[model samples]
Target chain A: MPAGQAVPRGPRTSRFALRPDERRSLGFILPFVLIELALVAGPLALGFYYSFFKVEYFQLTSFRGLDNYWRVITSPMVLGSIGATAIFSIVALGLTLTVGMALAVHLERDSRWNVAVRAVALVPYVISMLVGSLLLRWIFSTDAGFMAVVLGPIGLGDHSVLANPGSAMAALVFNAVWRDSAFAMIVLLAGLKSIPPSLYDAARVDGAGAFYRFRRITLPLMRLSILIAVVRLLIHFVNVLTFSLILTGGGPNGATRTTGLALYELGFVEFKLGDANALAILVFLFNLILVAFNLLLFRERRRAP
Target chain B: MTIASSPVARPWRRRARSRSAINALINLVIAAFALAPILWGLSTSLKPTQDILVYPPQIVPERPTLEHYAMLFQTGIQTPIINSVIVSVGAVLLSLGIGAIAAYAIARLPFRGKTVLIFFIVALMSIPLPSLIVPTFTFLANVHLSNSLTGLILLYSAYQIPFVVWILYSYFLSLPIELENAALIDGYSRFQTLRKVVLPLSGPGLVASGLFVVTFAWNDFVVAVAMISSGESKTLPVAIYGYLGFYGRDWGPLTAAAIISILPVIAVFVFFQRYFLTGMTSGGTKS
Candidate 1:
């Protein structure tokens, strides 16, 4: 867009000579860069490097190719944890998005109570995972959580939700959704607010029903937001560590063990640094694939529109 | 204009009376479904453990008492509210310093791989952290960094900086550039431009990042539990985690500890008023 010829010229260092503002910029960036080099990037890169070698007392014993990756795949506990993580993620994602989107739409429609509800909705989100898990653990405890008491008339009874594998996983997902739904709602609400009001007027004039208009106009317009919500929820589900770790310790009998918990066990508890790093790299790649998949879905939706 | 809370703008409001009644019914159902857990959490926190174990249980506490709250304050479990304050404040202060400089660079300075650097900051959000815990632990182990308050601060800062940079960077980017240019024209140095003009104008971003850093570090349990083994260095979440193992599954005290942990985060939410409104809704642009 600049009035330059097609030939790519060198960066205009001569014209864009360093000014006092630029010097200030260097001063600002210097410390943060040093910290990152020493702390984050260093750990991450070395984390990968150490995985290949037998890391013992700051020394790499020897580079054992593929051994770490193989251990992650073949180890029963680790693989089981991965399977549990997958199940936990999928269940939580489905429940949160459905419930969260519904709540967002409800808030958008029920404007009278919107502020009160929105504040309450945000309560769980702001509360530390430590707190929420603790609260829910008490409320859903096998003998006397409030959920059982509330559902008692309906014969649900006061069984500890965590005692049952299905319910334990359900409880974990339940607590997570309760907290995370606010985020999904916020994203969707932003999207909903952005839609042109005229589209609703146009739909009404055409005598299209509310459901149909929502299906045709709102859903279509919400594509980007929904995609974002899904991606966010996906990231949350896979990477979530605190809730599962605190609530269940992977489970009563590994019923609720997830890949994340497995990584912690392998790396810290078992001291399998290489295996944990390999698993972590795999989780990252796995997440990358999910993100790519969501993008692909977004592109397809755009093309169809 | 402030978006008023009125049903007039909603599509459902235009329906007939009969249809409206049905719509209200559906809305109530959804609201109740969503509000159930909050109500549930409140109920159990008020109930005695013996009453808690009663199946086909009472919905409300028969004798509503502060016993659970009392239990939470019991020793071997409680994270002294002051400890939570220390870590959360430390997190906010340190992360702000680091994020401010890094954000300043990305926002103002023209360096190579600027886009790449931005991407790296954003990418930190999506990376599954479970994987990192292992390597992080091992790395921490080598440096004798494990089991220290300093280690927890360092790791939390690492996590918080990327986020702080991101929120602040966009805000800094959006501020009018002419102020910095004008300061330069007036012969004030870049440092002066930042100190006087850029930084002052970008208070909202700083406040927002401050809120985020504080909230995150306050809520964090994983790093605290992993890095620090000593009771003195152990923060609130770690203390709460220890409560479970220590008390041998006493939900009353555990729930109490959990509530105590959140008071600081709540205070933070209330304190950073303007930042809370503008900041949280500003999602990290990863999506």
Candidate 2:
């Protein structure tokens, strides 16, 4: 049926078209819009608002203005969490990017082995972070852990990584990269696919070595994808909570306590609402800065084109 | 034959063979790195209590046992699994229904503020969820929604709706507008057209988005930990964490519970393997 064949008779005559198209569209959309605003946008605004006030046991007590922010900024735990988060994000992001790029490059072609490895690699991504952390705990456990069994004969027996602060942090970083690199691989794989093969072919025809072609062609084309993956991985790493929570429980003197875990303790465990809210806002600002940086990279790429 | 006898061709063949060998080596490492932890967990899950603590642990148990699995089912793990299923499925249904409709409006209908709405969804996608937990907890408590599965479902749907809109919006855009226009010419209302014509075409999109929502809601810990403290509404992830605390030395049942927690997720991934990859990658960076 052609649209022009239907005459615009009285709008009220058609029972199905009782309302105007605009109204009907609005009706279809308003439910989602209203619920999303109330649940998502509303809470975000409330987080900002709550940062300025004191609340105890689910009741708002008084407005503290900047005191909460002042205390949170000066708090050692907050500063420590910042430092921890920085270390975790840098190490995790670097490893994930390296591993993910390698996987993408090797698995870019269509082969049975590549396909199987790709499928298996995604298992960790789908598994809950909590469960993934648990799996790592078992793998790294001191008593009969896989690592223990593998390393026992080499005089590195009974090693409990989670019992030591530095090693626990390493465990956290390892787990972060393990779960997230699959995501990075998928993103970079798409980037590799998007690059015109003709560019590589042209370089080959010019007698460029494989390494030269990769450096001159693949790296430049993959720059944006790398940036995107870095930002996303940074966000996940910086906000990492469950990995530490379920694995190390921030043990061995707060070794793996990222800012996210600190916030969890503040809000849920200690009920320090004002401080928690202030810290939440601070984390949100940091995330916004990262996202802004990502947008800048994107804008620069667009301008170059 | 002349080329085959040439020294250059001999070196080239050797190089090609070595390159493939290197590729094979890399593939082996990748598979081991990815599957080692999970496979270890599975091995431990099947091991008896005595074998789990033995020195020079065997990669494959000599006598595989289902005792730990029986123990897992007999314990409190069941509640968390049930809770996870309810919240995840509820989130999938809620987000798809509401998000698909909104995506349709954005894709097909020329409504005012449509661009702004799309931008809003994008911005919402970037909001760090952990930062919002404090206020969300407070808000939920005030509304008597705290510690409830319903509240968790609502929050999960809200968090997932942004990706739903982003992915489904693209899916709907790829569809020809003329189809909807043709339905309109047949005197079918927009809602009827969407219900009768558009939905059948959006099956793949729905499956993709639904799979993502299920994975997220099921895998989440930050939200569930913040919102629900009691076993009444605690999810699998949180419950499994509690198991770690309680059974710190009981690797047998603990690993078994961990396996049970992840079994459904692995099933979904294996069953919808293609959609999961496509949806997640596409959702990673919008075109």
Best-matching candidate per TM-score: 2
How much is A190 displaced in model 2, in angstroms? 1.2
Model 1 bad stretches (over 4 Å): A1-27, A55-63, A109-112, A145-147, A150-159, A290-305, B1-80, B270-274, B281-287
Clashing residue pairs found in predicted model 2 = none
Stretches of candidate 2 exceeding 4 Å from the true structure: A1-21, A152-155, A294-305, B1-15, B283-287
Candidate 2 chain B least-lDDT 10 residues = B278-287
Which candidate number would show the highest lDDT if scored against the true structure? 2
Candidate 1: clashing pairs of residues: A20-B190, A21-B190, A139-A145, A142-A160, A144-B52, B147-B227
* Global Cα lDDT for candidate 1: 0.71
Best DockQ among the predictions, by candidate number: 2
DockQ of each: 0.43, 0.53
Tell me the deviation in Å of residue B146 in model 2: 0.9
For candidate 2, write residues A1-305 as lDDT tens digits: 25557545544655544334677889888888888888866776777777888877756699899999999988988888888888888999899999889888889986887887898887888887887888887777787566776767987767778888988999988898888888899988978988998998888889999899989999988888788788767767777787777777787788788888899899988998778888888888887876666555544644654
